[model samples]
Target: NTQVNLGGGEGLAFRNIELGTGLTEFESPEVISLLDASQFRLLNLDEKTSILLTGGAGSGKTTVAIHRICKLCFNKHVLPQDILILVPHHGLVLLSRKILNSIGLDQIKVMTSREWFRNQSLRLLKGIGKEVCQDTPFRVSLLKRHRNMMKVINAYLDTKKLEIVERLKRSAFDDKKIVQFMKETAIIKWMKEIMKGDLSVVQKMLLEQLVEELNDYNAIREEIFKDRKLLKNIMDDQSELITSNVIEETIKHTHKQFLEEFQEEDSREHTLDQKNISFRTPDDVSGTIDLEDYPIMLIISNALNGGTINNGETLKKYRHIVIDEAQEISPMEMMVFGHIIDQERGSFTVAGDLAQKVDPISGFTSWEDALVDLNLSQDLTELKTLEIAYRSPQKIIDLAHHVLGPLAPKRIPISKKHHGGVLRTIGEHEAHILILINERLEKLMEQEPKSSTVIICSSLDSARRYREGLRNLANVRLVEEANFTFKPGVDITTLEQVKGLEFDYVIIPDLDFRNYPVNDYSRRRLHLAMTRAIYQLWILSPSAFSPLIPNE
Candidate 1:
């Protein structure tokens, strides 16, 4: 028993709660005595079944998941190479690979969802890539084949439309064509940007029309105007009809859609040549997949491909799959995972904490909904949840929940007393924060020179700008999508980019309210940023982050 100060000058008595009924310790790192019985049971789940392991920030769900891999590799004699460990970001891949390697389970395939799909799509089509840059050319091939279309793309675009409509008003450009193009720009996005497809029958007609015109612009314009009835029917729903004589001026962004769809039925000569694939533009409805999000389209394309490469030198269908950071994947992506697992009809494991989900793009709502979406509810033996945090300091977890506010679920803290964190408001006019950071960083480094630390920013651009003054420090690097190398020094990074990473000390600077508002996404992101600190945390802001969770 211990005496606790109640902060209001009251004293209360309490005692530490032990984990399980027995005090015996197990020899394996995974089987430590302190581990909650629930976590141990999760590690020993049936190898032939799928699993979903969820927990709060420091609940050791990751630790349990890694242990399960060890169990599969050694106890079940599963080959390391056969295990497909899919993760949300590259950092997680690096971290998972290290943990797996420590258990002598080398050659496990660690990949982002994109890399996995790319390998899958490549094996199905033997080098039949888009001479046109594929957003994976397999995607272009899929589009031309009419297997992946409106339904999947529309679902993906609709979410984006919701986000964009909230951020932007209807555009003010005067030209009707420009307005139409802008509307389409926000809808279908740039499919033409990466797609190099074989010409459709209509594009051939447009090409011939362009070739035969003697007076160049005027002649082509006249020919197009002459066929207003036919062209109008072709572009019936579009606001901009082909009436303008200034063809070049009018055809700017909208022409690609028009030309891609405009092919003659008789002109499109089909041949037995296996390589010659013809592409036709479907009359686009409200939306289609944006090139910016390639994975969404791949989900649709893979669905079209029916879970296997139908052709030569195909990659083996993975019977054992493991997905990490499951909360970061959207509902549609859950469908993709469902399709793969169902096709192989094999068991897999997925682990994540809903509280730590910070990705704005993620469509996860609740654990029940996630299971239903993935069609795993009935098959799931039980939903195992880890409540005790083994990593985060109590102070940090308390702060995280405070930020999450009244609705967030409570978590048990297993760590001893936490101290050495600083949450201060550094006014814009106050002494240069950079100098203070530089001095503090030097002190931390001198004590633990080999330890890792990171200076957290709200965005990559902010991190890029903030790191300019910190370059004088040793091994201080900026973590971005293209450049991420975690070393024994400070790293400048943003919330989303730094997922599945930890540092001995974490510094969160530049906490401007404009950048981080009192919103769900922002709070979740801040919560994640807070939990990254394995030891100490420092919150340096221009002002208080949110009124709900003051740092005092």
Candidate 2:
């Protein structure tokens, strides 16, 4: 019999180690001890170690990670703030936040890259704006010069109206068109002459030109009777010409100067600023402020840097970082976050099934290569695999596993009483299939009494089509690309948009090869769609595409 020593530096090889010669009954302490010894051999945790927990859907990887975090926090005396958890999407953030809250770690903060960026931007804006305002005299002078240049241009045009009219007529222009054309042609030059060299003068000039152009349009339309087509063409040409010129000038002359100013202000403020603003909000309470108005990078930078130099104190402290749907995070972003945290002391957990990276258009793909790409191999100390699934039934897991190829291991045990559902293979007829799915959803809703039924599609187009096709169906809701809220009844949404969500019954309207190409990303998306059902899952695919599934 082979004997092996587990754990410790000095150990015999498993094949060479010998077991003691003993005949113990099954389920006895001796037998259980042997099993426990082998299991204990598999569990190893060391200081400053990185772990990769990989498994298919329904695998206990999440449970294991959570348990591991709890162990580190309670047993190891690691502060909750010292653990960082990164989830794939905002929806997963919500899910993880709920899980953390339920575990009584309510003070643990959950933030997305967007949230981090907004906080940083606000910090920069607060610090830089003061310096910017201190140079108010220069700005006011520039503004005044810009205003004078605009007045001169306006007066020049007013005094030389006939000459301007002649130029416009020569160019086959009407009064409305001529005014627009002159404004577009002369605005930039006028501004440039006024600033002497200040780029802001160009911005101010553009603003003045825009106002004058609008007033001119209004004045001429009410004052002059000109040909409608000519007026329209002139107005269109003028607007296009002015916008193009402004953009080109901004890029060529103003952009670099503005950037220099910003950099100068940033450098000065860095020395004087000592505080940074930090904002936090609960998942349920929506913030009314628009995030698009701020630069996301600045916000994240400030937050990760322990708040801006404007806020007196930093926000919530979190050490454990969990990034769910890890497969979707871009490598650049992953690198940024990895740099922000002290890897030796902080525990970063990334949970994502590679089989569900669907949003390739948004640069979303499997991040398995991140370990090598980011040179994180040295830091990754533990690689754990979770194979036991508790989400979907065995049948659904099986179907998803078949489509996901080798990535999805056949480890999830079959449920004893899975809610068996039909997998219909339709033909090129997508419309008829959608109708059938709608009918099934309606019937299911009538029978189930609850509004937990959902129709998940592979793409936004498919979701919208399903919604438009079933618009008249009562209690049926559609969640298209722009819609955020999840209403009751039969809801239709794309797979990527509905991650970390579940329904009592999920009907995948179309799972054909045409829709879900056998690419890395598409297959993962299909897997995500299949696994999002709690009780039953129905997949409708074309007969030709049925062979895409691996042999069970």
Candidate 3:
């Protein structure tokens, strides 16, 4: 244990030997102690049963889950390959993989829900005589869209669309040909920009027709010119020049390249007929199959509808399924998976806390509602709640509970075994706020270099601003979903991005009314951010604090 003091004699302890850089790394598998009788019992659950585990931050939910996997593998002799752990994001997937490998259960598979769904759908498709392309040409297209040149092209096309739309509105040309010309020009310009003026007749026609069907552009919206407002919004949006055209052209290029390679191999095979070279032609490539998110869901939904996955023949590989961060799983997704799971003898373990739900559009009311959506209410062998937080200090949990206000009052009292955490608040002018934060951070780093800290913000924009302001500092990074490295450093991220993650120290800068308003969602977000800190939490602001903060 290492002790550190943040100014004014406020001290905290961090067990870095046990925590090891972060939650993903553990020094030993024996870290799962038997002191928590509830956790011990949970690890020894019946082999063929399902469970729903609920807990708040630092409640050792994930610890228990990992230990349960170990117990199944070592104690019950369950094959490591027969278990699948589904996490919400790529970061958690990496974390789960590390924890499993640390315990010598590396054969267990860990995947994001999207990946699991796509792989399962493709497997089922192959079972029914459908040829699936293993190569993802769409990834190249996606990469191109995020490049700087694509932004410049999009800006240019947006300018042209606005000018053309304005001129069309002023003129009396009400013919459909004018609309077609405008759409044709946009597609031609986009292709020219992409291909550097090298265009083909077939490619041009395909792009023009396909641009209308692309979900992002929906060129059909501008077809009839129902209202000028709609046309203007569509033109300004400029979804046409953004990503849809790149995807279509890349797929075509990939198919063309494959055919050329095949013909070259065929020519070689003709000279040596002794060698058996049975091959499928590129013409067999299915246009209906795409690995993109929406298409993956569409294929899975089709399979579910056609009874391809209803029999659970393709899903018999895994006897146990563990889904962490279950709160983020939407009802529709859960419903689909529930239907498939019910068909097999595989048991599932889902663990999440409803209080940390930040997505308002998911319509995830409660666990009861989710079980009903999954059609697994009767098979829910246990509804276990882990209310004791073994790692977090009581002061932090108390403040987090205060942020929940009435909601906290209704739930069972969530207590922490550890005591004496630090909660510090500092108010300064907008101009000098960053300076104060820097001073405090420098002092904390000087005291404890290995302590991991995260500066939680209200939004991505806020996180970027803080990251830029503190760019000169050492080991400070802006965490994004694509590049979330949970290393020992000062991470700046939003509350949503930092969900299902914890840190040794969490700093909430600019905790004012503008950033965190007084509302239920905002309250939950603040609570979620507050609970991410295991040792200490700090709230800083330039003006009066948000009403959600208790005036203690």
The numbered model that scores best in TM-score is 1
Please report the candidate that would top lDDT against the real structure: 3
lDDT of the candidates, in the order given: 0.55, 0.48, 0.59
**TM-score for candidate 2, residues paired by index:** 0.52
lDDT string, candidate 1, 188-249, tens digits: 22222212445555543433432232113222222332332323222223213222332233
lDDT over C-alpha atoms for residue 420 of model 2 = 41
TM-score of decoy 1: 0.64
TM-score (all chains, Cα) for each model: 0.64, 0.52, 0.63
Q: lDDT by residue for model 2 over 253-309, one digit each (tens)?
A: 222223322333223333236643323223211112222223222223232223422
Query: What TM-score, to 2 decimals, does candidate 3 have?
Result: 0.63
Ten residues in a row with the worst lDDT in model 3?
Answer: 217-226
Better of 1 and 3 by lDDT: 3
**Which stretches in model 2 have alpha-carbon errors above 4 Å?**
1-50, 67-84, 101-103, 118-317, 342-344, 359-380, 405-422, 425-431, 471-475, 481-488, 541-552
List, residue by residue over 1-552, the lDDT tens digit for candidate 3.
Answer: 012345311112223113311232233223365226767887788866678888877677777777777888898557888888888777667666766777688899898876776666556433221223545454332422122322333343455455545544444434553465455543433432433434455544544443333222112112211222222232224244434444445445444433434433335343255674546555444322333322223223333223333233445446777888888775545655565553456667889887777655443557887677566755646778877775556787877888887767455445543434655555556556677777777887776677678899888988898888888888899987725665666889877676666677788888899988878788889988888776667887788788888776
